[model samples]
Target: MSKKLRVAVIGCGAIAQRRHIPEYEVNENVELVAFADPVNERAQLYADKHNAKAYMDYEELLKEVEVDAVSVCTPNALHAPVAIAAAKAGAHVLVEKPMAVSTEEGTAMIEAARQNGVQLMVAHNQRYMPPHVKAKEILDSGRLGKVITFRTAFGHPGPEGWSVDGRNSWFFRKPEASMGAMGDLGVHKSDLIRHLLSDEVSEVGAFVGTIHKEGTDVDDNATCILRMRSGAIGTLTASWTYYKGGDNSTIIWCENGVLKIDTDPVDNVIVELTNGNVERYQVGAMATNEQQTHSGVVDAFVTHILEGTTPLVSGEEGLKSLQVILGAFESQATGKNVKLD
Candidate 1:
């Protein structure tokens, strides 16, 4: 580990620019070695910025380049294949969230990493946010008692605002994105609720719809009723139609009080106990679609790779959270609650 850890980013898109590249650039131990994207210019753009090699075909990049880590920022469908290939090539992988379209794919990615003795980390950045980290600490302290329920949401106008390609972004395509807002936004909350509460969703009932966006076949809005293994029930909503401002908030009602996060326009975390005591903490703000901030994912992934340790969001954790979203789809199609196995 004397030399800086060599890193490469697959799929030089908006996320690579906003989250991956910039964060890696700031990390003192990482050396960005290469970049790859389907679009040659996109790959070259980031490559030029970092003085790294560029490739259009990621497979070629893998075959020719030797790197210690790779950030898989490709479309949802490609997450598994690229990660598996990278793992087999002896590179630890930090893949984007909603790890894969299905559990089978996610499992394969995990297994590939396992067989190759490489770490597989998922980019579930919400858990790394200042407010969320503070929320977890408060909840873990048992100052609020056991969390009984929560109403969490992650919504924005749509991918057109954040995606590099605007409306032509792969986020609008079913084949590329797998699920729309749920995959894009909700999975973060799904993983967050599980992280803060330390529970798994056992059942799900959802209403997934393609409302508003006339051209897209994928859902633009999703509301899921989740039943955690601990018997805590709550609602999780993901939407691409919150036009006024982005909503990235979570309100957890515990046995003794309620904990509000990212809700107050001014405060970071709020505590309203049953005894009429109100406290506010100024942890920090969440990064909106219009803002560029450090996600903390790249640094964590690099650290895990260097230390040979498990990440906060490992591939298995990613698969379980992904199952919750997949269950939502099943529930939406059948109009009945889907119990995850």
Candidate 2:
């Protein structure tokens, strides 16, 4: 607890390369200890860059290296297994979003960390976005009154542009990804909306489908109508086929007016009230495939471990967001509203 936290990255793919690795390097409190990936070249590349040891198997890395924490950035299928092992190894865990592919798996991961007494945090970076942070502040300050409805969208050309392997990325493989855009993008917004409004999604009605992606059977588009426990209603859309560009914007309509977050070309948060008053804030830009920015996920994870504090997106929080998306999947299959218990 007094020295720099020894850390290992369990996956060396795009997310790790773009966010976790560089972020960890910036944190003086963390020591880059090791990396593991099924593809030795990928893991070795990052390990060599940071002068850390590399392992082809994460299990071996966890067993051999004395790491204090690990970032689980593997494919969706490996999240539970790797996180559980890290917990059992007495290492804190920072698993990427869509924590696991199933409710049972997520539950087990949470239990593992609980039993082991190690911090288990899911990397839901939207909470750290400048606009999102400001929006939460405004909402909590009672400036927005009460949110009535909202529409949030997250989209890009496809994961081909973001994934390291291009077209053949595990993102397109149904088995590896579990859910496509819904898992990749939808879950982010799900967690964000919940964070922003402090509300839990109670009912979900959705239309999920594989529209234009050629290499995958997983859904490429998801349009969901969510009713929260507070009786607030909203719509969420995630797509990999937004050919023009990415849209990471959310508009929350409240009793007073609408709070627009990341909608304007230059402004980060624009508050437009019914009284014809407008307030614009230029906080910071959100990261994209074209422009990589600092994601605060790693810093939070490290600080939580060092300070012995529960993370914002704890294992339980990640499971709740995952359940929202899973409910969307169920609604898509059954053509009925899927209620979260």
Candidate 3:
């Protein structure tokens, strides 16, 4: 058998514990080698569990350990610097969603990975969801005809309800998280819409506000209007006020029919044709904070590293999604439509 690739996880935060580390543990192509976090105890805990080395400083870990790849699960603000440093250290990077806090940061990280000849993938797991996969296949089959418009939403009570740090998590801090719902939740919908339509967002108009949640300088609710390159217009919303439960549903209106994804409790993907025909598919259940099954991110990242191929959610694709959210923020600030170049 081929030797397993050495993998290191930076940041023993909620995402690292729940998704990256767990997924990497199951991937046969990888061997978890090291764990790093600012909190030494957190890093040591995961390291002890996995029988790996632990370090409080990622820079020290990168310099000392010879890792083949690293997962950047730190807060949004640290995404760019840590990913760039990891690439420079000759390690492929699987960064969490939103890519970075800004377009400049995202671009810099991509350039660093390109310069280092290391693969860089974003953990945009929404595209890997079964319902989303089925939706993409149905749309590509021309059964939906030309997509006219769509609406997508990703909302939950708050990250505090899920994060290991609870109410005092970095997710609520503006400096560490940059933005709240838009950065944390909205970016997922933006990336998913782009993946489903295979088009870029050309323009955006948005309203972002702090309707709920206290002790934070970030927006808790955000709504945006997107104009796709294919001339399809849509609405995107992200909120932290969905106190009942998380709702990650999408509706697409096409010329021939409408496709609803993750909208029903029974059917994960539903397609209705103009000729009075309806198809319902029971794709796997949607992932939630309480019940997150294996997201294919770590496995795909390992596959690309082992095979020396590009990842599905490459850094460039991730940057596009990040730019859309940044454009929405600009739109919110200017109170006008912002165009993407």
CA lDDT of every candidate: 0.92, 0.94, 0.93
Q: What lDDT would candidate 3 get against the real structure?
A: 0.93
Model 1 has a clash total of 0
Model 1 steric clash pairs:
none
Q: Between which residue pairs do clashes occur in model 3? A: none
Model 2 regions more than 4 Å off: none
lDDT: which is higher, 2 or 3? 2
Error of 1 at 215 (Å): 0.7
The residue-level lDDT of candidate 2 at 329 comes to 98
- Candidate 3 worst ten-residue window by lDDT: 21-30
Candidate 1 lDDT over 1-341, as tens digits, reads: 57998999999888888899899999999999999998999999878888989999999999999998999999998999999999999999999988999988999999999999999999999999999999999999998987788999999999998899999999999889988999999899899999999999999999999999879998999999999999999999999999887799999999999999988888999999999999999987888878767888988888887787899899999998899999999999999999995
lDDT for each residue of candidate 2 in 49-135, tens digit (9 for 90 to 100): 889999999989998999999999999988999999999999999999899999999999999999999999999999998889999
Clashing pairs in 2: none
Q: In angstroms, what RMSD does candidate 1 have relative to the true structure? A: 0.9
Worst 10 residues of 1 by lDDT: 284-293
Q: Candidate 1, after superposition: displacement of residue 295 in Å?
A: 1.2
| lDDT value, residue 234 of candidate 1 | 99
